[model samples]
Target chain A: MVAIADSVPKPVARFRFILDRRNVLGSIMIAPAILYVLLLVGVPFLMAVYYSLSAYTIYDPSWSFVGLANFEDVVQDPVFQQTLYNTFIFTFGSQMLGLILGKFGALVLLRPFPGRKFVRALVILPWAVPIALATVAWQWMFDSLYSVINWTLIALGVVTRSQAPNWLGTPHLAMLSVIVVNAWRFFPFAIVIFLAGITAVPQDVLDAATVDGAGFWRRNYQIIMPMILPIVAIGLVFGIVFTFTDLSIVFLMTMGGPVGATSVLGFAGFQTGIVSGDVSHGAAISLFMLPVLFIVVVAMLRFIRRREV
Target chain B: MGSGGNKNNRSVTRRSFLKASGAIGGAAGLAPVLSAPFVSRAVADNKSLSIVQWSHFVPAYDTWFDKFAKDWGDKNKIAVTVDHVPVQDVPARAAAEVSAQSGHDLFGFNGSGGAHLYRKFFINLADLVKETEKKFGQVTTIGKQLGYNADDGSWSAFPDFYINFPGMYQKSLWDGIGMKPDTWDNLRIGGAKLKAKGKPVGISLGHSNDPSTTWRGLLWSYGGAIQDAAGKKVVLDSKEAIEAAKFVAALYKEAMTPEVLSWNDSSNNQYLASGVASYIVNPISAYRTIQQSNKKLADDIFVIEPPKGPAKQIMGAASEFYGIWKFAKNKEAALEFLKYYRDHWPEAFKASEGYNNPCFANLVPKPMPILANDPTSTPPTKMAILQDSDKWSAIPGYPGPATPATDEIYYAFILNDMMTKTATGQSSAEDSVKMATQRCEAIFRKWARRT
Candidate 1:
């Protein structure tokens, strides 16, 4: 009876066996995701590239190939040049502040303590809340005339009526204020990532370091930092991307002002391309950030993969 | 065994049929998705006109506008939907519409400049303008400049109204300083004294419509025009322009606090109503807001003529326009509605609490009942200045035509930045003017070359 059963044909089973190969199965599983990216991301990016090269406005469907004219306009214009500098300042400033604040927060929370969960919850508020709501609230807090901070300072006799600082008025102060607000909103995310990385550090290794008379600073600087380097690198990459392309905070707070002092490339692009009716020029301005971002992401990805290996 | 084998075969065939049916249904789903536009077009062909506008600062204005449109729709057997969004978001929303190439049939912008910005997307309304003007007198000088393109003689929009920007000041504060702020110098003098008394002047230096209005008034008074009368060349680098820049900077330093640097359109209203500032250059809406929020403060609020400069006293206002998009399914109905509304301007103007100043001079009658007596205003004549705003008021690119280029400069807050940069001491007045001139030139060149 067993030999007779084995002689039966199974055409469906043979076809299934071919599809079940690892490479074929993997590709089939990811087909939907790949198609989604192609339709949404790839096509739009290509359209943007085309728009940047050609004379195109939203109203017109036709385009005459203007070559590098938009890019030329962008490069020669002093406003776009300032925007590039501004993007660098905002991204670098906010990311550095976020990393430092996040590490400090994670280290403190890493320790066993009371209300630790509650403290962590409060720390997560900025990350949990919506960006627009949080940034608008910050705008009120940093008002030029009625700043709550200045009111507090005046109450404490720290400053007089005329001596109070204008947080978002002066150019440098406006840039600083935006960076601080941005860092405040983003550091919670970094802290969460760093906390997980810190927990992954081996307990035996820390105990061994303590046994060797390693002090607190030595343990963190020499031992823990190197151990979390890969994770730190990932966090830095995320912070850089987020800060570089950030739109809401700068737009809401200073509107890239006190004389376009706070206008990053993203906000400038929106103004030029969409609001001011210079779409191709806007695309060109935005594309300037791509190569630098790509290189940074690729380098970080390789570093991540090497560590994993 | 035969019966069991038959049952298994039937189940397999049934499962395969279900699988094929599911696949076919999924593929068919894409058909509707692809043909959605055509179907919508068919459905909307007979649909009533739709309008999108800024929610008026005065709640009553919206109530009046919405009801008026609905009534007109009822008479014409059309369904009218008026969607009022916040004024600040009007530009972004317009941009979104331009990008999608689909939106409200009749979109209303807070300022006339928006029509110029997206001129290509609008229907040519030259004939409609001529018809409306014949019914109502010649549309005011501003009405033509705001709604029509000079080069092609095409009307891109129909000018609906203009909101006035007058001097809104605290009566007691001004009396104490013994200054009426009748001149630009008087504002600076009074504002400085008031600042020392702990209540500074409130005028925005940020990217806001109010700032653009205020600065333009100053620039125009100083004989500084953004462009020549033809709107062809950049002329912001004049000696008068630099003088205006310096004067504004001195005012900022001596009188206003840094708060003005961050003020949005509503911030000054809030500041004045909060009693933190002695004076704010704004529309009468600020005083009205105070009337609702604080009656005591509202009583003290008095609006006078806009401070004068050596050149002239120009009210920096952009006429609000209602434009019909070329892609509109109901352009014929939209044009009909617009003509009817303008024909019935008297009722609309009175209903808007004088918030909607008429574009046609024929609409303003002698003894202008609304301005002479207002139940909401402290003094009956407090709002009278608004009735005559058309006399002194001119849009941003005054002396020159309000072209797309001028509108772009206003929308971009170009003048606001120049004033702010100088005020904050980031750039010298001369240097700021030079930079602004360069920017204005580039913008002019872009639009000039395009046309």
Candidate 2:
């Protein structure tokens, strides 16, 4: 009787009796989520693949199959090449900086302090503020002529008005400025995650390290880090994906300028596809993200699973 | 008997309303494809028009336009709605409307770029333009260059107004240096001296509309043309074009601040209004803004025609276009409204505080008291030099028409990229011009085939 009930279709089988099989109940519970993913991620991703194989314009309805040509055009263009280089640099630079800074902030906040709650909120403010508004403010702060940073530097005699650096004008500096903004925005979330991971370490484990005379760095790198390797991996995965695909900072601040030195994959795709109206080429540029991000996610997941094992 | 209450009456009223709506929808669906706007309005029984326009930089202009539109609607018994969005987001919103096949009957673009790109989606206004032109004196030649499409012999959009892209300078700054900001060379040289004093020129080199307008003036003045007069060939690789690039590189290094590489449409205005910039290439709006905040600076500031390059006295202008969408729901009303607006534009010009320069000959150099002496300027002759800008200025595609090809160049900001590349020394002037020529040719070829 039970076997017969299990073999029945889910909707029909559900009312016949209370679901006994864990697998069946779980599948039924997750069906809506599976459908959501299929409709949202799977559909758009498939559409992107199709678009990358065609020549499409945003203003026109007609398109033709020119298989792999869009990909070739994207890969061969010098500006696009620079954008690819910039994407990796930005993602890696921001991720490493964010991780280090976040870890430091979390450790400090973990200790007892005055107004810790308010301090925690302050640490999270960069992440909490709307990115568009934040980036616009940053754009002004980095302005070549009116930058407060330049004013401060001038006051300190570190730089003169004529010698002041144009934060978003020089190519390398523009890339660095974008990465700095991205890192600052991203580190708050990292801080929260690290805080949770640090708190999760068993009292005994920390005590063991303490009794063993481990320094703060030693404890963080050796005992605490190993114990929270899985959590760190998760944080890194989210940070990498967010940093890799970030468009707002570069778009609002530099607009991928200084000869596209600050152009990341996301901004380049937007400029080429949306602004320029070459939708297919933009899809191709966007699709490059898939393979790179997929590998990152998979590798991090695998590393976490290995740690668990 | 008493239970026969208001519920039944409400239900009956709703049924009647739905039936009327259904009939209207049915008729509208079957109307001539080109007359979608008219058919929809006809079945609705009430004359209502909707419009979308930029939240104008000069906020007072919005105040005037909205009040005037509402008053007109009241007199004509037509309900009118005007929606405003930030200027930069206009194209996306318009594109969304086109995709949805439903939106305001009329939309405005500050430049002809988006209008030309979405040519297939705009109503042909040739008849309307001709009538308006006949009534008002003919639109300035720049207006014809922007709105008239030779491909279909139709006005893809109606030209309404133009803004002169001239140099606005601080008189005291120039005086202190024993010079005047008259020519491009003078600007570069005098500007360098001022930069040493911590005030630099603020012409944009970013991917924004200003650079497209400002640099074209520079490019044209240097005998450089992005394309030949035919609009069919790429002519951006000439020595003239390279000279333009080389000159800009020197200016970028010596006179202009590097912050211009990241400027948005509003940045230069801020730079100038804050007293950090000695001169900028902009319309009179910036000076007007400064006047309200800093009458002292406003008194010190003066306007001049765009400095001459090596070639001639060709200034750049951004011609605003009024495009009624083909899918608009109130086409007849919208067109009528445009005719009224065009004939009544002098009033708008006054309301814009002399910022709205009319596209017709007679409408301009108007005896409007505001022009003779704007309350916003110290000298009162603040607008005098700008009166005859039509005599010297050209739109984006000067040598050529402002075709979809040129529109692409403007929208993608290929000219800005070329300038940025040359200015930043990422590529030599010759290499940058070559690159720009190649890119421009690709765009022109793509659109040419379609046309």
Best by lDDT: 1
Which residue pairs in candidate 2 collide? none
**Clashes within 3 Å, all models in order:** 0, 0
Off by over 4 Å in 1: A1-19, A58-62, A305-309, B1-46, B74-77, B364-366
Q: What lDDT, from 0 to 1, does candidate 2 have?
A: 0.82
Instruction: State how far residue B114 of model 2 sits from its true place (Å).
Output: 1.6
Predicted complexes: DockQ each: 0.41, 0.25
Tens digits of lDDT, candidate 1, A149-259: 889988999998678877787778889999999899889988998898889999999999999999999999999988998998988898888778778898777778767
Report the C-alpha displacement of residue A242, candidate 2, in angstroms.
2.4
Model 2, B261-327: lDDT tens digits are 8776778888989898999988778887888899888888888888877679877887778899888
How displaced is residue A139 in candidate 1, in Å? 0.4
